[model samples]
Structure formats: C-alpha cells, structure tokens
Target: MSTSFAAESALASPADGTARTVIRSAADVSQLVNRGAAVGSDARIVIAIALGGVFLDAYDLGALAFGVKDIAREFSLTPAATGFVASAITFGAIIGAFLGGYLTDKIGRYRVFMADMFFFVVAAIACGLAPNAWVLGGARFVMGLGVGIDLPVAMAFLAEFSRLNGRGNKAARIAMWCPTWYAAISVSYLLVLALYALLPASHSSWLWRLTLGFGALPALVIIAIRSRYISESPVWAANQGDLRGAAQILKRSYGMDVEVDAAALRDTKAPVHKATWSNYGALLRGVYLRRTVLATVIAVASSFAYNAVAFGLPVIISSFLAQSMLTTILASLALNLCFAFVGGLIAVRAVPKVGAWKLTVLGYAFQLAALIGLAVVGRPAGGAQVALAIGFLAVFLLGQGFGPGSHSMTFASLSYPTSLRGVGVGFNQTLMRASSTVSLFLFPVLSAALGTKVFWIIAFAPLAGLVALLAIRWEPSGYDVDAEDFDAAKRT
Candidate 1:
C-alpha cells in the first residue's frame, strides 16, 4: 500500500534459482509495461489485434460511401431519407461512444472488446439483407455501435501494451491508428472495385449489400483468435486492487514471469478513480479541460472534413469531373492509397522523432491550402483544371493522413492515464461522431445546392484544427501520463 512496498516488490528471484518479476500494485504493473514487452511477446499480438479492430471501424464506416446512390434508388428514398440512412451509423456511434467509454472503464477492456465484435458481425449481415431503408439504417446503426465501442478499447490496448517511449512508443502506437484507418478505407474501396467488376451488369445493384456483408468476415476472424491472444489490461486489473490477476495477465500477455506479493493481495484499497458518470465531468475541469477541448476540436474537425470529402469522394469525382463510375472508383482508390495511406505511414514513422505537434501543424496547413485551391478552381471545364481539382483533393487527404488524422487519437489516448483513458477517448469520439453525422447528412445537400463552393465551407475544418493546435500547444508524444495514476494513488 505504500511507495516503499511498491519499490521493494518490484522484482524478486524464487528459491529455485528462476527470476520472477514481483507486481505489488498498480504502479508495479505500470512499471513493467513502461519498460516495454519482451521480444515476440503476446503483447505485440495484442496490439495487432487492436489495430484489426480499428480496421473494422474504418471499413464499416466507409463501405457505404460509393453505394449511397444505389441505396437511394433501390429504396425510392428522398434526399432527406437518404441522409438519415447515411447518418444513422454516426448517430449510433455517438450513443455508443458515450456508453462504451463508461462501460470500457467500468467493465474492463477485454469484455467490451470481445462483445463489440458481435455487433459488427450481426449488424453487417443484417445490413446486407435489409428489406427496406429503415432496416438498412437500423443495421448500419448497429454496425456504428461496434465502430464506436471498438476505438476506445483499441486505443487503450495500443497505449497500454506498448512502452511509454521509444520508436514504438505509446504516441507512435496510437498514431498508427491513422494509417490503419486509411488502410481499411483503401481495402473497402478495393472490395467495391472488385465487386463492381465481378457482379454482372444485371446484378450491379447488389454491390452495396455484398460489400457491407463482407465486414462480417474480418470480425469473425478476430473473434475466433481473440481468446488466444487477448488478455485483460494488467494495469486495469492492478488498479482494481487485483494484483494477483494483474500478475497473471503479465505472465500470459507480456511473457513476463511475475508473482503478486502476499501483502499487496491482502490490501484491498479502492481504485484511484472508480468508473463513474462523474469522471466524464472531470475531463472538462481542472488540468484535463484544455486537453479535452483541444482533442475534441481536433477530432470534430477531422471527422467533419473527412466524412464530407472522403465519404462523398465518388460523387465529387463522377459529378464534378464528369467521369464514369469506373473512373471515379479507380481515382478514389489511387488517391487514398498513394496519398492518404502513404501520408499516414509517414506520420506514424515520423511522430516518434518529429513530435505530434509539428506534424499536425504541417498537416493542417496542407489541408487548408488544398481546400482553398479547390474552392478557387471550382468545377473544372478543361482537362488540366480537372487534374488540378483532383490534385487538391489528394493534397487535403494527404494532410489528413499525417496531421489531425494521426494525432487526434494520440492526444485523446495519451493525455489521460489508464484510469481515464476509456472515458477520455469515448468523450472525444462522441463529439467526433456527432460532427460526422452532421457532415455526412449535409455534404450531399450542400454540394447539390452550392456546387464546388462547398469546398470553402469544408475549408473551415482544418483551419479550426490548426488554430486549436497553435493556441493550446500540448503535445502528447513521449509524455509519461501513466505516472499520474500512481501520483494520485500515493496522495490517497
């Protein structure tokens, strides 16, 4: 229960001449994780699985992008109804994030994670076979819940499983979500393309359903293997005053042979921060308020711009550039893979060295400039002008890959320790999903009404993100935020 107890119990060798790490408290478990996992440890596999969850989030969110029009035609939906169907998932994500955040902290990461996979598999199948617009919308909403719930826990795994600092540090691991997200989006685009080619012209209308249904494949794969590779977060267990449970998790997940001290097991003190509704308010008070504000703004802005541009990308290309559907798909796919995905990769590799703040700033600048260029160019009449418009769109996505895209979650996850990580990311995602709902609903209407001028409105997103980053100047990379939990525990 004391600091000296933790220090003394940090390590020990058994009488049989084998080394066994001693975990006496939450701090001890944190120390082991902070020191990084052993090579080829299950900890790395856990991180990979967490990223797979992220892949699902991106895939489901984007799978419907190209098929909205088909859905509209098939369902005989009005523009307003179409908007509702498109935005329903985000609405579900909004509610899911709020609840999932609390549940993740209250129930534990493993339970929330394992349970959300069912949401994806079931919802995806329902979406594919829905009989009407209402059914499709409901199914998509369920899928959105899975996406919402997955992010907070996925981020927790990434942040907790990796070391506090280094090439693959917490910041870097968290930032990797950006590239993984883009990769998932690219994969969805590829799927659409493949289905488009394979499906006969007579059955082309089935494209959306088939694409959405495919989401179940990955979720089921993750579910089957989860029991083998996934384990409860050791720090969460220790925080609950279950040192024995924490030690076991370390042995299985981190490949560390650890034993809980008898005295530590006997000490049944309450955790530093019990999972409570009040913790949500804590994000807006005292030290966390500014961080919450900055992270929320960055997330909202990123979501708005991305949902508006990326989700509507096929439409923009087909209508604005006057291109065919095939051309639109290929262009969108190439742009995402070559620019957005590549940029995300750069951000992941560079964040550890260059810092998240600098890259985010540079990324926002690129987005802002690109948006302005698109606004100025308007609808391109000539071939060169068309190329320029596409170039601007590519630039905007490229900026997104590295800047707010990669670091928004970085700020959200690392700004809080394990105690508040779930709620922190949950709160951030809740607002971000709300923004997505608005953007997804409005982009079609706005584009129809304003034409290319909509780029000017979209330009505001990155600009806001840039302003927030400059004003706040809080960088999450390389920071030892987990120490806060121990400091608070000591105070109690």
Candidate 2:
C-alpha cells in the first residue's frame, strides 16, 4: 500500500496533495536547483548558530589548558589527578558523541543541540565553582558531554544549511570550526593574560574559574541566535515525511522564498518504522561497508594524531620553552591559528577537488615525515632543536591543515546518507574520541618515559589510516546528499 501522500519525505509536495514527487534514481536529483529552490539568508544564520555549538566545544576544550595549572595548584593535584582533568572531558566527549549522533538523528538536530547547550551552561558554572579537583574533574566531564554531543549536530547543521546547488562543498564552509577553536584558545590566552595583569596571584587561581566559565558564554549566545533563526534540516525533515512542515520551516525560519518543488528534492521520507540494532548491521554490508571502514580509519587516525597535539600541547611545548604559563598558552594558540585554522580554510577550498581519501593519504605521509624529523632532530633546551621542533610542527600542521584535520570531519559527514548520517558520524566520532582520550591519558606518561620518541609511536596510526584509505577507496565528493537518500530508497 502506498502512503496517501506518496512515498516521499519533507521534500514531498502538497501542491496538489495527490501527485507528490518521488525520487527513485540519481537522475531525479539535481546537483543545482534550477527553480523553486531559493537559498535562504536564514540558512547562513543557522549555520553560524550551529557552528556556535562547535565554537563552544572549542572554547571549553581550549580553556582547559588555561585552567590546568591553577587547578593543579589549587588542589595540589598529583600527576594522575592532572591526567584525570584532561582525559575526563575526552571520555565524556566520546560517550556524548556516540549518544548525540544517534539521538540527534532519532530526535532532531536542533533538539539535541539545544539540549547539549544546557549541559555547557550548567557544567561551566559548576567547573567555575568546584571546591576540589574531583569536583572540577566531574564538571569537565559534563562540559565534555556538551562538547561531544554538539559536534555531530553541528556538522549535520552545516551541511543541511549549505544545501544549495552542489554547494556540497560544505566542508569548506564548516571547516571554520577549526579556526574557531584556534580563535577560542587565542581569546582564552588574552583573557588569562588580562586577568593576570589585573588580579593578584591569589586571585589568579580563581581566574581559572572565569576562564572555564567563559566556555558557556558562547553557547548562550549561540542558543539565542539559533532559536531566532535556525530551521531543522530540510533533508532530515523530508525524511521524516514532514514535507509540508519542512517547506513551511524553510520559508519562515530560513526566509526561503520560492516554491519547493517536491520533485527537485529527490523526494524521499525517513522510515516511519523505528530502526533497530540490526539496522547497524546494514552499514557493514555491501557498498556501505567500504564507507564505514574508510570513515572509521579516518576518524581513528585523526583522533590519535590530533589529540597527540591538541590535548598535549602544553606538555609538548613545556618540553621546549621555559618562559611563562602565558607564553605556553600563546604558543599553543599560535599553532591552532596557523595550522588547525588555516588548514581548515585550505581544505575547504581544495578538498572537493582532491577528495577526502587522497587528502587523508597525503596528510598521513606528510605527518609521518614531520614526526620522524621532529623525533630525530629534537633536543631539549637546544636553540637549534627548538627551531627544528617549531619547523617540523609547521610542516606537520600543514599536512593536518590540508588533509586529516580538515577532511576527517568532511568524510565523517558525507560518508553516510541522512537516515544513517547521524549514527555514522556518531560512531565515527565516538571511536575518534576514544582514540583521542586514550592518547590523552597515555601521552604525558609516554612522553615522559619516551620523550620525542612519543612521536615515533604516534606515527603508526596515520600509516594504518593510509592503508585503510587505499582499501576502502570511495570518495564522497559531488553527490547532493539528497541523492544518497534516494539511493537508499531504491535499495529497499
């Protein structure tokens, strides 16, 4: 029996009610909308607000560095305690990413996003007011939940909002999150510096409170803006068989003008039936199996490599420089600015052409060389060694900036269709966060035990990632995400 409204999703038209457009092939999907699909101004605003969720993640994550010394001093924490402070957030992030990705899809992107922000608000304040290291660690865990939950939602949001005529180059658009993290850390450094200059050392301990609390502020701002402007994903909406509702949202929330031709949307609906665990079994079968493998390797590799640097920057930098806490903060922020942020930008421009797998492969190769050079040439307290470290760092970052760092998220999002996107990205993120958290926990001890030799150990992840890239070689470059949904429909 056919659905009375036809077998179509939110992109299904009510224009005539009976004759709704249905997509059964790629030919039905338009790479560029010729008519009736107007890109809305509100779409851009929504992207910004969704990205605010990511920016909040970045802020909280970055603020930890600024807070660490004060947290250790205030609590007189042992190395284990200190490690707990860093790794706890990562643990929460892993869980949250797993849950958030699945739940965001089960619920809706905006609902999970809003729900996660509240975590940041409450957790940020708790971190600011924690009486002891344990309490502070717990608070960081909460903030990490908020951070983890938002990442997949934010990625979904960015792609959905930018869905205009082959602008599937949304990775280029959303890689802004990388730079945003850099900016967050930079601001945190400046904030810490300002407080240090103005407040006494006794008060500087509390400044960490302020720095940690600052993570919530961006979330609040984002929530405010998103509430006013954001629309749920039209594609997601269509999948839910809320075509009329989706269209109304596009017009009202996003300020989209022009009629939505259900025909153009690759009209499809989300399963009215609830998906079960066996649904996950489907991802490992047939064509999608390769996608699953490819994305998983990328996530795992990016998580290991990125965490080796992003989470352990202070420890790594401390090995080389001896000026001040502020100097350490500033130098770490500089790497984010030059490497992570610019890397994202360069990726947005070039990734579509190079494809995710190629970029990831190239990134691993460069990262491997850079890590080897750093390990060989690195010497503690030597000027030339420091110079070499910095040089290798730049070279390493360029690889990340161009490939794994930028393309990882891109691949994560595009690797699956909408019905499965949340789960796919979520699973990928969870694994990624797991690798990152494990490394976060182990890095300090390993670095202490092995020092520059740690780089040698870290190099293996990317090498494995490179191998995986070759094994599962699908590139999610040009298809309108809408088409993937249609492909899924045909499979049924």
Candidate 3:
C-alpha cells in the first residue's frame, strides 16, 4: 500500500502474513460484494427472506380470486361493484410502487422493508373483518400498499446480496420469483379448499373471510424471521460514502473478514448521486430509455393478459360450466396446481440454460395457440367443448408460468445500476399494476358483452408481447449490471 494511503489501517491476518484492502469508493464496495457472492457466501438466508415478500405479495393478490364471487353474493354487489372490489388493491399498488421506489433509494433498504410488513398485518385483518363491500375494498387497497412497496426493496436486496457464480447466479436468483409466486397461489388454493370442505353449508360465508385474513399469518412469520437476518446493502452504503460501514456489513453479514484501509477512502472521491423523484426522468433521457421501453411493454402485456384470465378464473369458469360452487373452486384449484405450478418450477430450473429471451418467446407462442383455440372452441357446451376449454386454459397458464412470468421482474430489476434499480423496478411494476387495474376492471364488463369472443381480444396482448420481444432482442439473464454501466460510462 502507498505510504500516503496507509495512514489509518486495521490489521487482520490468517495463515498468510497479511491481506489488506482499501475501501476508497463505491467500486471497492462493489468488488467486495461481488467477491463474497462468487465464493458462495451464506446468502440463502438473505435471498429466502427477500423472496418471502414476493410470496406474500402473490398470496394476498390471489387470495381474493376464489372469494370474489362469495363477496359479491354476500354483499349484494353489482358486476361493476365487484370489478371495483377486485381492482382496488391494484389501484393502490400503482401509487405504492411509484412512491416506494423513490423511498427505497432515499431511505435504507432495511428500513423500508421492515416498515411495509405492518401494512400487510393491519390491512389483512381489516379485510377479514370487513362487514360490507366498501370496507373490503378499502382494506384491500391498504394491503396493496404493502405488496407494492415490498417488491422494489425485496428485489434490490436479492440482486445486491446475490453471488454471480454457480446456482446463485443473477438469472437463477431472479427466476426464483416465478416459482415462489406460483407456490403462494397454490397455497391459497389449498387453504380455500380446506376451508370449503370443513365449513358447513350454512356457514359458507365465513370461508372467504378466513381466506382473506389468512394472509396475515405468513406476513407475521416472515417479519419475525427476517428481523434476525436483515442487513443493509453494501452498495447503498458505499454510494453514501460510508466505506467503513460497508466493510463492517460485509464482515458481519457476509462473513468476509478483511482490513479496510480508511486512509485510502480519504484520498479518493467516488461520484455521489443520491436517488430522488427527479431522477426518474433520467430513465427516459439516456441509455436507459430503450431498456425502460422494453421492460414496460413486457410487464404491461404480461399483467394485462394474466390479470384478465387468471385473476378472474372463477368468473370465467362459472360462465362456461353450470357446476356447483365446490366443483368450480376444485377445478380452478387443480388447474393452477397442475399446470401453472409445474410450468413455473420448470422455468426456474430451465431459464439459466434456455436463456430468458428464448423461454419468453416459446411461452408466448404457447399462449397464442391456446388463445386461438379458445376463440374457435368458444364456451364448452358439450363434453368435447368442455375438454377443449380446460385444455386451452392449461396451455395458456403453462406459457405464462414458463416464460414472461419469471422474466418480467428479472429484466426490470437487472437492467439498471444500483443507483436507479429500485426506481427502475418500481416504475416497471407501476405500469404493470396499472395494467392489472384496468384489466381486472374491464374483463367482467367486456366478457359479459362479448361472451366467448373475449378470448380473441385477450389473445392479441400476448401477440403484441411476442412482437416486442422479437424486435428488442435484449437478453438480461446473467448480465453484469454493475460492470456494464461502468463500461458504457467509459465509452461515452
């Protein structure tokens, strides 16, 4: 080390004589984190906790899918009113995503993360106890706030804490979101089924209440476990010019012990760009503009299609089949478990090898075929028609779970540098949630008017998505987000 840079130092030695590092700038902090990940640090605890937020997000969102009908029946709701109830959470999510993104960057990741869990707990209890449609809608909107805020922080934690080698690679870690989401959805289904089976026919009203409120259980559990393991992101610390803080976090959380020369940090200056609401404009002005567009299109297209069909699965099935409520819920539960769950698991395993680009294209192709089949078959009147509708539904879910479902969040989160990653994902999720709000509100109204022709209209969303993918052709899987930005800056 230079004598000028060695004025302040802490000593740590192993079998080797000495190993000394200097934390002079954000780059040094980045290197420390990257090296820790490369060596396969105990990051699983961090990742699992981060992903727990996603599981809760999906579970809370999908919990209402089966309960919507009962909610309508109990509250004497019109179709428009029911649509509002379904859309309320997404509407709140739009605002939450926008603000949460800016706040995650402004405040520390751990602060924002721990604060949001309280939203889940309170809102979930309110939703369960809602006596009227208005109250339920209000409670869901509040719960949506937690769901929306949790995502950007959770994703940032996952990416920053992750190692770039072996199974802990960027794509694989990001791809884990899909399976966890599906797992949450499947669990909701099973919970509903168990409640339905155990409850007496006269007490069927309590079923939906239990389902909606049950979301609090997991939220509380995650909060309890995460508190013990949470650590601030080293990159965020480095960005703030706290080299010692970053080094301590690495040693304490990641188990990477090293001596950081404080004198070196005093000698050099790293660029300081704190995230603010104004910085959001930067996404559209420079190199990030194209990436922003691609992420938006994919996220919106996926959200539109998924919300239209999946969120309203109960309503769609009820229209086609004149079965008992038990039968309807059972069939929907089976479809998600067998088809969607399996597809998501396969994508989690296959994405690193197949690449995000190819998997998404293939998934869209499957969606196109299934939708066209639905358009031709219409609603199932006979035995053959019934099988075709069910078969096509399976194909569509398979495609979604296999392709866009896994990569939409992955692309947005991995496309930007740490300075802007939270806002990048927050913005992406905002548009997606907006799309979700619109789709959920419009699906019932449109389906009621168009009948089976609605499938034809919904099919076009995935087609447009396919076109966007083929045109852009940027595959972010396993891309070095930090290095790429430095390279670009150097070129300019």
| Leading candidate by TM-score | 1
Q: Residue 348 of model 2: what lDDT? A: 69
Give each model a TM-score.
0.96, 0.87, 0.92
lDDT of 3 by residue, 1-492 (tens): 111323134355657756545556666666556655424554668788889989999999999877777999999999889988988888888888988898888887888889998889999999999989999999999989988898999888888887654455666677788888988988988898899899999999998899999989988997888756778888887776677787777766777664556564665555565788876887786668877888888889888988888887777777778787777778788888788878887887786677788888998899889989988998787988988898999999999888888888877888787888889989999999989888877787889899888989899889988999988887877666755433445212
- After best superposition, candidate 3 residue 149: deviation in angstroms? 0.8
Off by over 4 Å in 1: 1-16, 270-272, 489-492
**Global lDDT of each model?**
0.88, 0.71, 0.81
State the lDDT of candidate 2 residue by residue for 324-383, as single tens digits. Answer: 777776787688677766776776667656666677788889888888887887565688
Put the candidates in TM-score order, highest first. Answer: 1, 3, 2
Give the Å error, residue 182, model 3: 1.2
Q: CA shift at 460, candidate 2, in angstroms?
A: 0.9
Candidate 3, clashing residue pairs? Answer: none
lDDT head-to-head 2 vs 3, winner: 3
> Each prediction's Cα RMSD?
2.1, 4.8, 3.4
lDDT of 1 by residue, 292-324 (tens): 999999999988998889888888888766768
